[model samples]
Target: MIRRKVVLHFPREKVDKPIVSKLVRDYNLDFNILKASITPKEEGLLVMEITGEDEDYRRGVDYLEACGVEVQPLSQDVARNDERCTHCGACLAVCPTRALYLDGESMEVVFDREECVACELCVKVCPPRAMEIKY
Candidate 1:
């Protein structure tokens, strides 16, 4: 199986359609919605992780494109600057995946990239502005 994180932009007219659901029913793909902003008859945005066979994933993407949904890799990738971080532990409280944690002995904040889903929670709470989201 192939796993990919992506952001889908839905045109105003397509906002009410069950596009994501079709990927599951027709393409045999599984998705985890990390974030979403969808309003009926308005532009919508979806951040999700999709898993499926490589070919199914490709075909699913094509299907989405055909439906006029713009697809792109997840753009909000959060990165921490070690030098700017104060180890204030503010991020630990907001990280849903426990990607940010404190080392018991060192008393410093540690970031685990693999565990992170780029949820943008850490970026909002970092007082020192150490956490940055790259587009």
Candidate 2:
């Protein structure tokens, strides 16, 4: 199975559609929604991790784009600057995904980029301003 994080932008008209469910039923992709801001009749955004076979993943992405959903990889959204970080572990509290954690042996902050869903919770709580989100 392949797992990848992606952000989906839905137009106002598409807000109420059952689009995500279709990805599973039609394209055979499993999805985990990390964060979402969706209101009927308003533009919507969803951050999710999709898992599937290589061919199914490609087909699901293409299907979303064809239906007017803008799909972007998670790398474009969040980043951490190691040089500016103090490893204070402040970000760990607010992280919903447990992406930020302290090393048991060293008591240093450790960030796992792959597990990050780009929710930006760490960005607000970081004392040294290490977390950054790109709009």
4-116 per-residue lDDT for model 2 (tens digits): 98989999998888888999999999999988998776799998999999999999999999999999987666788989999888888888888789999999888888777
lDDT of 1 at 75: 61
Which candidate leads the pack in TM-score? 1
TM-score (C-alpha) between model 1 and the true structure: 0.84
C-alpha positional error of residue 36 in candidate 2 after TM-score superposition, expressed in Å: 1.5
**Over 4 Å off in model 1, which ranges?**
103-108
- Provide the TM-score for each candidate, comma-separated: 0.84, 0.84
lDDT of each residue in 54-113, candidate 1, tens digit only: 999999999999999999997677888889999989998899989999999999999998
* Predicted model with the maximum lDDT: 1
**Model 2: per-residue Cα lDDT at residue 99:** 79
Instruction: Write out the backbone clash pairs for model 2.
Output: none
- Model 2, residue 116: C-alpha shift (Å): 1.3
